[model samples]
Target: MSTTIVIFDPANASHAALLPSFADIHIACIGTDHTIATFTPPLNRDRIIQYWEAQAADAVPGRRIIFMALAGDSDGQQQLAGYVVLFRPLTETGPFRGSVEKLLVSPDFRRRGLARKLMDALESEAKARGQTLLTLDTETGSPAELVYPKLGYTQLGIIPNYGVSPVDKRLNPGTFFWKQL
Candidate 1:
């Protein structure tokens, strides 16, 4: 199957259907007991859809929040394979920095390099916007912890008891990472 990575257009109603699957994927991978900064599953899909629409409408060029998705070709039936969000700070004066948020791939679509593809696209977009740095955080021992380092991100430090796991509701550590663009 061929897949294409593109910026999600919030105005497109077709993309809203993909949000539920994205929520399900995150819940399955991170467990129902944990919540990331960008998503807390058992998602309020309607509210999230509204939020994305608002963000997309209000987005400023080069300093906007974007949601990128990896989806099957539109030639036939289109399927949302994975997604990630890149948030560029809207500060008036400061070093340009972008943050990676909510990187997820469907369980049925794992092991196919979708996450890397999404991240690479995000990095390219950030650099093109003149961003000089990127930052992100992941569960300390999660798959993403390994993936980030492999993608050239430097570990900043681990935050103890940073968040509660969605599956078990137990506290979990989070590791922060940064990359110079």
Candidate 2:
């Protein structure tokens, strides 16, 4: 497989367009093949569209939102296999002084290290932008739960019912993860 690691920010025109591709990848990643039924966030078509629209080149956040996409190549084909989104925190003591709102990998592309590549790109981009802290939340059953701590992310407090599983009415607890750059 061909893999390219790069850092992108929504302010860039190309990166902004990639946001929609990232959203599409996320949706395609959550399914039986990925076994993410227990961790899938509650998302609808409208919400997905809103998310992509919010990342437009001119729709800048008060603090910029950095987007990182990992493209995988196979059979002379290139496609976005994973992505991450991070924003600088406005708070004085937020862990890592930044928050990673989203991290996703295509279901067919999981277990291929694409997620790790995306995370690494996010970390590098964050540090380049002078962000020292990085924070993220994942459900108990999330595949990243184990990989994250191993990746040097310290476990923070947990938020009960933080994850609303799309398949169930009940919520799954979410553990927060953080790391210093």
List the global CA lDDT of all models. Answer: 0.72, 0.67
Highest-lDDT candidate: 1
lDDT of 2 at 103: 74
TM-score of each model, paired residue for residue: 0.81, 0.77
1-181, model 2: which lDDT tens digit per residue?
7777665655557666676666676566554424233235554655665666665432365364544445545666556677666777566665348787667777767787777777787788778777888887887776778889877999997888775665655677888888998
Q: Can you give the lDDT of residue 173 in candidate 2?
A: 83
Q: Where does model 1 exceed 4 Å of error?
A: 31-64, 73-75
For model 2, the stretches where C-alpha displacement exceeds 4 angstroms are: 9-19, 32-47, 57-64, 70-77, 91-96
Among these predicted structures, which one has the highest TM-score?
1
RMSD of 1: 3.1
Lowest summed lDDT over 10 consecutive residues: which window, candidate 1?
30-39
